[model samples]
Target: MVSSDSQYSYTSSSDTELYSPAADIEHPSYISKILSKTKPDEGKARKSIAETHAEGIENTLTRYESSTHGIGPIESVLDEEKPEQFDVKPDTELNEWDPWHYPVDSETGFRIVQFVDNDRDDPRCWTTRARWNYTILLGLVCFDVAMMSAIITGDMKSPAAHFGVSLEVMCLCVSLMVWGFGLGPLIFAPFSEEFGRNRVYQTTLLVAVCFIIPCGAATNIGMLLAFRFLDGVAFSAPMCLIGGSLSDMWRNEERGSAMAIFSVAPFLGPVMGPIVGSLLSVKCSWRWVYYFMIIFSGCLYGVMFIFLPETHHQTILQRRAKKLRAKGDSSYRAISEIKTRSVKKIAKDTLLRPIILLSELIVFLVTLYMAVIYGLLYMFFFAYPVVYGEGKHWGDIKTSLMFIPLGAGTILGTLAAPFLNKDYVKRAKKYIDRGQIPPAELRLIPMMIGCWFVPIGLFAYAWSSYPHISWAGPAFSGFSCGFGFMMLYNPANNYIVDSYQHYAASGLAAKTFVRSMWGGAVPLFTIQMYHRLGYEWASSLMAFISLACCAIPYLFYIYGARIRERSKYAYSPVQGELKDPEQGIDSSAQDMRSNHQLSERVIDNE
Candidate 1:
């Protein structure tokens, strides 16, 4: 008996697991209670594996039915709902269904292996100290991935001079890698879901570490560029998997604090990149930049391989089922094994759905707003050097220190995360009391408040960037920008996940692709933009753009519900009258359930 916490009760572990963050396996008692009400007879229903397993095993059924590639193991509560799909009959010997058959109760016929109450195998049941240890380690990995994006700027001159290329070409090093970050998720997010987080984490990170060696040793620009892109793609697995990994281990109420700690890594890593890169470039050589990444990332990979356990519920159950079968209990099965998907279906979900979701205004504006913010972060790597290094004659090492305030501001945002989450819970209680899900707009309050900080920082940095002014003026301005960056990032990801139910994965993929592409390109033209427009006006240009973006949160906050009501993919409380005849389920009922899950599941990572 899992106690129902109203704060997050909208999702049965089963409903929530359709998206990766929702995939926490709960006790079978809870699942049976919920599923028996929905499908009393159980056996005759032709529901997808997702609906069939929406009881105890979390993603076992949902991930399989939704676009996550396969389901996992659901216990005995629900039998073979879609026997037609499998073409199995009651008397057909168990071997005929071999790898896919549900474990049979000699009398009742169908059973699925499941974790019992307080089962040690469930990640959610792990000790608090263990979970926190993994959380910090995961955050460190995120920092390393983001750091690589900007570290090259520390001594761009050495690389450009050595290779006989221009500074603009060096900018490609950042851009191409960021581009890889975007594209990598399209492949890796699903891969992590299918293969389990630890395997993907170990494999891709090892590849990323290996590729850095080539980057360090490359004689030609071509070799360096090729390997840099590959490293980006490989390192990107963490950014995609860490969010889901955290979800696997933490319950709803406990996740906010962990996420706040996690959120700082992305911004802090980039901020520190120039600082480390510049120090090493001056004391050692530009090649030391790549060497540092190899050493640092290799160490993290070693730690992860030795310490991290498989967090994906489906993979764990699949392995458990395999072991049981090895002992001649052929009836034991994981949901993913019974459910099959075509390559075309998988591609549509991973590739085309994100693009289609962008057509929805919420997805587009939110994505565009994020892209602008991301581009500005990258732009600063160039803009600061122009203001301090070139304009005021400060050396690279000194100029790199200017990023400290930004890092401090991001840490400040992280400190504020718990309070923000607390505030949301307080506000949401009113709706919960009314038996209604809280509006997704509540998530945007932080974004609206945080939005002003970016423009304010930019305006300060712009006016203070004059050569005669104290460096303090331009340098400390980064604090607000960095603060705003962390503050805006987590809520925006929550809003997207809340707005799109089963489709949240694709929605996030869309945002990452667009954001990464724009962030990657910003450095290429930043110097030229500053020179042509003059530092003050160029900074003002971005500040004003950020100022304009402030409307995004308010606009969505006010009219977001209306927009979601009309959207096909975005979760809406107002459901249509349609019903599925074969499954005997009302579309409206499904939407309402999905709506509740959306309001409750706050995904802290994207």
Candidate 2:
């Protein structure tokens, strides 16, 4: 006899109520019908009752089988429309039978599951060790080469002079390179998302190498500038892709440390470039810089070709799905396969992000604050040489060497950043534990310290470079300014990255575009500014601007969380939730205190 106990019956009427047999509970098809008579909390009660009914049904099935045949039938459920019939077979027979004999499902599944949920903690996702290593290595190489090019191109004044180009024209070449770098992301970001990251990176790096080689052989300033712009375009691919690759490799918590290390290049490149370029320009022609870059780029290209596999999860899964489809299997699908949007729509959205971010009140203000600081810092590169050489009677080499203090300050600041970041988190957690409202504004402490030092250093550097003051005074100011620059940059960037969890790339690109534009433009007019205002008053005016920027960190420190709460783009407690504001000590603050202590100890030892 057919088992009526295991069967579930449904009526044809769509609005009819059905009851679960085990729990004797009824639920209506429409939620409105249930809510009309029941209170809101009663809906939850209905769900609990349905769950109990399911359990009772299961128990009843077990008991019926135990009381009757002592074992269940081996018959399998099959769709009646299908021709194939299930045949009982031995273990060896089943193994020998074609696994493909099973009928395919009518529905096509999605193709982008891997990309959507590639977290390590999730059982459905996993990335290989080799893939992670390759991502990081390729990222390092790509950024190193890109940054090196920016540094060398920016410092190629001697070559421009040799070519009879005015300094203004030469500086324009630098500005063009920066413009190319800024615009490159818009093109590459969407392309990487469309094509696989590895394919895009490999193709672009090769193009960059090709452009770099020709750059060394350029006969005129225009040719050199044209080649450099192309090179910038090629180099930008890696910068845009690396962040996504990092997200593929590491979890949210682990990403900060990785990003911190990756971020070191953009800062260090400028410092390292001038040091190396100064030596190269003095010993050899500026063309040798391009030649050197070509060699480095070529080596990196080979390394990436061998080591970098496609890590973009969608691409990986798509490849897997292709393999499955080739075998006549229909279960394969990618997460992105479900997306119905056209490529044009995706491109349009990607293109508008930087503009949209700039329009945001908070993002715009923060970006402006950071941009001014960055411009001022870069401007000092040009200003210091003129001040120290003409005003203090120092040689070109000696004036360039004065940047060592700035380098020292950057190193000290970078080393201290992790600890400070850790302390801020710890303190936020502490606030949470104590039942206090933890604030995102607590992150502004270092920024406050940094803002104060920025102006102080600018004023000191300006006034101390005169004939009366010793060179040590100006160098000390450089150190202080470098420290302040790091303080301002790190916190602002980290805060933004933390605030916009999914949109971090767009946020970073927005900030990077503004900062690079400022860096590119400021050097061109630095001499004019200094000449018009004289060093003392010119830097003093900059100091006043720095004073205004100090208010940014202060405002955020006070009202940051509230601002985040209202923001749709900003990461809220729901999305990779940040530490509760009140717990113990903010981890970032504690980290800063530790770093401060370490710095003091180092000074003491020195």
lDDT scores of the candidates, listed in order: 0.75, 0.57
* Cα lDDT of model 2 by residue, 273-392, tens digit: 555666666677777777777887788888888876665655665665566556654544543343324655555445556567676556777888888977776676677766876687
On the 0 to 100 scale, the lDDT of residue 423 in model 1 is: 91
Model 1 residue pairs with clashes:
31-55, 50-61, 60-72, 64-70, 64-71, 71-336, 72-335, 103-331
lDDT of 1 by residue, 172-280 (tens): 9999999989888777766754677888889999899999999999999999999999999988878777767776777666777776766788788999999999999
Residue 587 displacement (Å), model 2? 25
Sliding window of 10 residues with minimal summed lDDT for model 1: 69-78
Clashes of 2: 47
Clashes of each: 8, 47
Question: Worst lDDT window (10 residues) for model 2?
Answer: 68-77
Per-residue lDDT for 577 in model 2?
29
Name the lDDT value of residue 231 in candidate 2. Answer: 79
Q: Name the lDDT value of residue 548 in candidate 1.
A: 98
